[model samples]
Target: MADFKLTYATMFNPPEELHAGFDKAVEKLKKNMGQEYTMLIDGKEVKADEKFDDHSPVNTDWVLAKMQKGNSKHAQDALTAARKAFPMWSHTPWQKRVELLRKAASLIEERIFDLGAAMALEVGKNRMESLGDVQETADLIYYSCYQMEKNDGYIVEMGKDPLVGYDARNVSVLRPYGVWLVVSPFNFPFALTGGPAGAALVAGNTLVIKPATDTAWIVRLLVDCFRDAGIPDGVVNFVTGPGSTLGQALVDSSEVDGVTFTGSFDVGMKMFQDFGKRNYVRPIILELGGKNPVVVSKNADLERATIGIIRSAFGLQGQKCSAASRVLVEDSVYDDLVGRLKETASKLVIGDPTDRNTYNGPVVNKSSYNDFKDFCEEINQGGGKFLVGGNVKTGGMFDKGYYCESTFVVDLPFSHRLWKHEMFLPITTIGRVKNMDEAMSIANDVNYGLTAGFYGSPEETEWFFDKIEAGVTYANRPQGATTGAWPGFQPFGGWKGSGSSGKNAGGHYYLPLYMHEQIRTLVK
Candidate 1:
């Protein structure tokens, strides 16, 4: 177990010890269910006037935790606390900041299994995916710390100004923005929340984290790691509630210096527009959802292509932003690849995610379950055929939760809007292309350029790389066609409408997004 490392790409073949630890942790966590949680502000347990029950997607009758229903006032209180702590946190030495953040990362790793169990129950991700999310969050924080140390705190000595009469010196320094807010999505809740939060804190910014309503329990546990790591009082705060009151309040506030939001395209775009209305333009980093695509060439390995497509299209119930929602196959092998994809998808077990045999689980909530039905109806109305699944599961345990079958649609015309929409469900649309050129044309036609996958010969792989418009691209890998991004290995982000900043997170350039540069000069 010591020699083995875990990543989304490598999670398929983990050590047996890993499974044993996860099972033990799940048993322990089950005994502590139905506990009440509170929001964290100024390092104190703050309770709201109203509260909401967080239910497990695996079974709706199970109340995982009772969470606070934060309002606009609570949002303002969190911002004020973070704003007040900014001076002390920003002034702390960079090395000290790194030390504390690293401690927090270590805490996350130490509690990986416990957090993983919470995530599986809350987000409806299978055991491996849930564990991978927890481990990835720790790695992301460690990566940011490594980046901070590698760059020597982002303070660089520059060349002296050319002046014969006087001695001159110049230096460049990157500094943090104040009161940064992180609004994370339900999918990969741990990584998305803690990744940005770690970057923000390690860069010397104070934080206020707001997680998705459906998955606040896991984020609260993550916040506990930071707080337990001895981050100064008020340096990091957590708030949970509906997006309309609490989330919008945090976004609309002029006090927030910057923000990192991960969610839908329309909501992100709306926030971008609202930020523009401020007195001065402020930094807003966004990772909107993606309608990712995968292209299969005629000469590609049909077996490898089918395996990769099925994994990427159906993993996490296909709710990932990088899910392969569109698969364009060359006309010669379209039928062959589609048959294999349907066969592989049909074998994925849909039940409680905590179970060892379960590969797929229920959708995150009732809203998503209803959306899946609506989207399937829309596809059928537009002359699309379901190659695999198109109905909701019922009877027994399925009726106890928000269970929906993994769906693959075919014969959907290119003219149909579903071809380009981001369904964010276990629903993928397949299309046939006459040639590689036609496939590339259709792949790059969408507004999203987040992640893409290709399977073909060496020369064709190079051509696919040259032609694809996505930020993250993979070629001929059975692991995942468009999914599985690690921190140092594959820095994940998007382009065009998929992301606000061009720089990908967990990469070389991501840590700097939380900072602004200043040049200092002295003459004698």
Candidate 2:
């Protein structure tokens, strides 16, 4: 609260003091596992007849929590509650909303370790990624709050009209949509949910958040932070269940003023098309999955490119929408780059997420694990060669969890479906191109235009930046090639089929998406 700065998680140099705290928090959370988590509807806890268990991706036997399986009825209840609270909440002073958001962020920071632990178990992200996700959530809230203050509460005064007998004062005020529904994905549950929810709330809209089935536990933890920050109960609602039932009901509900979703492309497109069928036009903010690529030129630093591609491709087991799933290497240096990438990837540590030294964790669930295996098998059978890793590691840490080695494939045709489609697993395909032009062609050929990375000379970097079709791009970044976007620093979003609205989160256009412009003219 002193000076108001939101810093990223320092995984490499975490504070020694916080180390003990995180360890204690994880243990405490583990003991509380398997407890039933109810839906927060209209400031009251409601239980459903059916329930589902949240299990750790690292070990299915480990039940993180038991959550109520929300249905269409519960979704309607949430919408009704949000609509009932909308008038008072929408009229609440912008300064007051900002105050509450800041308080929420601070409270999240206070319980960062506990939230991190929940994320680790729920999403199978390593300690660093887990901690970073929670911290980023808090920062996302802060960034939205900052945007509100910087824009003067989104209330603009227009020029006055002069006439003989007419004195006209005109002003434009950005007003909130009635009620919003935030649909979050499994990966980055806290950040994705909190970021959009924070923007909607700060813009004076009440929300009903439905997290992915795999991440309900972590979502519950985040909702607690908002409740503790003095957000009125009905102002923010939380529900958990399958996307087919609960999510569809929320999206199809006529009561929802606007919607924000982050998930697969098919579902997002369906939601977009469905929202259009309403009687009136409504805004839909979407961040769909990406088949992102990275181009490594002949002039690139092979070591830097190797490290960047490996980290970006395998981070979070490549579950991220912005993960680099394709690599195009210049013909002159393609072999060298591929060899180094294979060597480095084979050395990555894959194990339980709770271990501090683990770099690669299990996939989010068994379905993803099967996807990893099937993709590798199909690629191998299609005459592609495994550059380094292709086998799934089993019988130890991987016995109960969904674990697979980081896989790199080569000699596959560029036209193959595996190369064009998104796998959303710890798998990457490498191909050789004649030059930067060819590399750029391959990178832009995919349907997704989300995030991209490039390593090349200054002229090539400029050319890449100018020609790349992605919404987010980076050049010569060692932290990550096509991933590692931080809030405020990099407002993360997608383009083309990868996103619905062109606006990126944590940027200037985000909060405005939740608002509708009202022009006022007064004659005195």
Q: Candidates' lDDT values, in order?
A: 0.95, 0.89
Model 1, range 1-524, lDDT digits (tens) per residue? Answer: 98889999899998999899999999998899999999999999999999999999899999999999999999999999999999999999999999999999999999999999999999999999999999999999999999999999999999988899998989999999899999999999999999999999999999999999999999999999999998999999999999998999998999899999999999999999987788998999999989899999999999999889988999999999999999999999998988898888888899999999999999999999999999999999999999999999999999999989999999999999988999999999999999999999999998999999999999999999998999999999899999999999999999899999999999999999999999999999
What candidate 1 gets wrong by more than 4 Å, as runs, is: none
- TM for every model, in the order presented, reads 0.99, 0.97
Query: By TM-score, how accurate is candidate 2?
Result: 0.97
Please, what are the lDDT tens digits per residue for candidate 2 over residues 157-243?
999987679899999999999899999999889999999999999999999999999899889889999998999879999888888
RMSD of candidates 1 onward, in order: 0.8, 1.8
Q: Which one is best on TM-score? A: 1
